[model samples]
Target chain A: MIGAERVGAAAAEPSEAIRLEGVRKAFGGDEVLRGIDLSVATHEVICLIGASGSGKSTMLRCVNLLEPVDGGRILLWGEDITSPAVDVNAVRRQIGIVFQSFNLFPHMSVLRNVTLAPIRVLRMSRREADVRADELLGRFGLADKRDDYPDRLSGGQQQRVAIVRALAMQPRIMLLDEVTSALDPELVAEVLNVIRELAQAGMTMLIATHEMGFARDIASRVCFLDQGVILEQGPPQRIFTEPREERTRRFLQSIIEAGRM
Target chain B: MLGGGRAVVVSTVSTIVFFGLIAAAFLFAPGSAQVRQEFFNLHDMKVALVGDPSHGVFSVGEAFLRNIEMFLIGEVLILALALLIAVVRQLRGPVFFPLRLVAIAYTDFFRGVPLILVIYTIGFGIPALGLRVVSTQSAEVYGLAALVLSYSAYVSEVYRAGIESVHESQTAAARSLGLSQWQALRFVVLPQAVRRVIPPLLNDFISLQKDTALVAILGTVIEANRAAQIYSSYAFNYSSFVLAALMFLVLTVPLARFTDHLIARDRRRRQAGGGR
Candidate 1:
């Protein structure tokens, strides 16, 4: 069982969990993340929704400090993570990331993939790491694939292994960037099943995904991001049936209509 | 538009005309003298023909052939040395600026200068500094040493370019999995790079075949070109020289085709997303 109190350190209140103010990032002339402010609460699964190139991925990346922000402050569990003196690596260790492409190490076995970071970065002994890795693999129903390489597994199996890898690190917050986007239509459910399981277990998760059903079903709150801003947000049921913002209503209509026709 | 009979007739006529011109030029040519004196040629070097040089063209000595074989063994050793140096240089310097700089200097010096000059400098000039001319087994050794020294530079850069052709993402993926830079290169990059470089390396090996001719300048008697010189001097005949030319083609052409086959195989494998 996880220590829920520390986990909520990641999400005490919408204001206290992740506080970002006037956050900005740019590469050359293009500014991807403009000045923005947002908060996420404890025991919450916040789904970031947006069109392509709308900066939803960048926002998720920012939370993990995978992409450094040029300005503003990112506070994780009351610690000012944006300070230059802060060890970004330590912050990264607490915040785990899973990418859309399922960037699993191709050269490692499925078990090794889950075990490497714990043994290397966490400095866990090999035997202990192996023990933890086996337990995790069994939970994900990948015990048979412990010795198989990433290339040998199905895309769904690989992504599940990826999630287990992040989970093995025991991160306070798990940042999932379109985790099922690369999966085949039939395979998407397998990966999403694992994500749903994590959300139910009270993982502090921020997911950038296109699956509206997943957002409506599992998300505590949903934020529609467009042009690098949070256009609108609310409870999944309210946003789905009674969106107050025009942009959120229009986005929902497009997806529902696309599904119908 | 033209048919097969027309092609055959044209080929037969051209063949007759070519042979006719050759016969007319050689047989009916003016003042082609046997007037060259025997003193102009050293018949003793004709030792290569009968594997002997006891009294020159009229005689054969097995000792000369043995010396030539000894020289050949030495040159092979030199080639091995050069290959080792090039591979080591490539493996050592994919990232370090200083290593790259040293590589650039090596290839630049060797490629920028002529091979004959490199051979002569190592062959004769080094001996003037008390290197003692390496007259026995070292004759072949010194020639081959220069050959390997000159060629290794070109081979190293070919390897470097092959290494770079592997995408940066491959390394990034490996490192993200907790591998160090060298480990990433060793486990991910170099294997693919080496496979891709095989055609160019084989091409390098072909160049090495002809480059062996440069050893003649250093007085090694192992190789065909030098053996040609020895045969011509002893019997005063040019047939063996022709035979040596034929032998070099026999070795190089087939090897080059085999290398081409490997290149094509790798390209096809890449198309299918197989490992390099």
Candidate 2:
């Protein structure tokens, strides 16, 4: 099963940055992801939109090799990251992920938070890491907050710092897992603006978000996940206006009813 | 402001009256004079504390320097060793199963045994083995080893609790940044864990300071309690023991207060919604 999937993926998309074929994940007896198959091309931004507990986060975690898949394989730029021998830390270095809650190191200053991975994992010199971190923080409008701890920053500032921290690693692909969900309504736009800027810069990204408007505005393709599988996927205009699957329509209708869009 | 001032006045008056009544009752007791002569005699206290060298009497105040030395050395060793054990126990994967079991057994065995028994076993039993260098060590050294081994077990549990209290998301955040497991623990988890458990760590140190008295059980090591015992037997008065108790209080009371201050500051920080 794995071999056939690999051949098919290789033949179909030579430039694909990430591909998941028949990926499955279970927490104990409860299956969160059941046979997920998707491919994201380089420099494309694909957004996964679904209800809570629909395995969106788990799917992203699997692609990052944070969650070990129960079955099937995950390929990163044609490399099989799901293999038991693959070093998870090396795989994660290439794929940067921003979480729903900004999990900044509370004990560290913002500059240290952004520079830590480069200094520690990448073996960059302290001065080099600091220069890179400073540039990223400046780009994100957090230059003045470098010495401040996470607890001292507003929700928006903290999330922006988290994004810059991820970006500092110079990752090939970025995964954003509901990065703005924990922010205030007013603060969401600042974070969304950083992501929009990243997308415009042509950084390949896979995002799982609840902001329908933001997803519709930023996504190159929209994927509707239901019951741990991609129920429907297409260009944003068609998927948002005329979803083919009933579950997709229902999920969109509920999102609209809740006035998220 | 008026109500607050009135409340303070009432509390102050009540505290004085409550203690004054107790003092009067104790003063009028049938054996109060005898008790005072035995335990609060100023001349005997001065003699025990400063030493009547002309009379060949040992000074408990001078001997307390040994307790402080033992406490200082034992404290440093316990912190390093307990943290090592705690980290070992936290190691994952099947390959570490044997090491994890050893850490668990070490803590369980040392914590379960009486400290005094541990002191006796190390001081006498090891010397009885008749090894060349090991058996020739002083009773003070053996007693110190026993304290270090026993206290490390308790302190390691405290360290473990602190490590567990850190949210799992913190580890996930560190790992997702491509840090190795050991790197994540060393740079991220441990700093935060050690911060959160400082108050409890200080509390344990206070106990350790007092427990240094147990070393005198080796019969030849002249720590404060042993010196007190000698002076009491020779002078036929208990004032020397009171002097020794005061010496311990001088060191431990300040530490206890410092721990309370740390706990209060931590509570305030949490209530302020900071340091999440």
Residue range B1-276, candidate 1, lDDT tens digits:
669999999999999999999877765656333322221223433334455535433222332333344335534653454444444564543466666566567778987888889888877776667744354335556676677777777776776777788776555444444445566676667766766787987888787776777677777435566666666675666555555555567767998999989988978866876322
Best by TM-score: 2
Cα lDDT of model 2 by residue, B1-276, tens digit:
459989999999999999999998889999999989999999999989987777667788989999999999999999999999999999988999999999999999999999999999999999999999999999999999999999999999999999999888888888888999899999889999999999999999999999999999999999999999989988999999999999899999999999999999989899998748
Clashing pairs in 1: A11-A42, B46-B234, B51-B61, B52-B60, B52-B61, B53-B61
- Candidate 2, residue B123: the lDDT equals 99
Count of steric clashes across candidates, in order: 6, 0
**Poorest 10 consecutive residues by lDDT, candidate 1 chain B:** B35-44
Q: Rate residue B174 of model 1 by lDDT.
A: 45
Tens-digit lDDT track of model 2 for A58-99: 999888877899999999988999999999999999889999
Superposition error at B189 for model 1 (Å): 4.2
Q: What DockQ do you compute for every candidate structure? A: 0.16, 0.68
Candidate 1 chain A least-lDDT 10 residues: A7-16
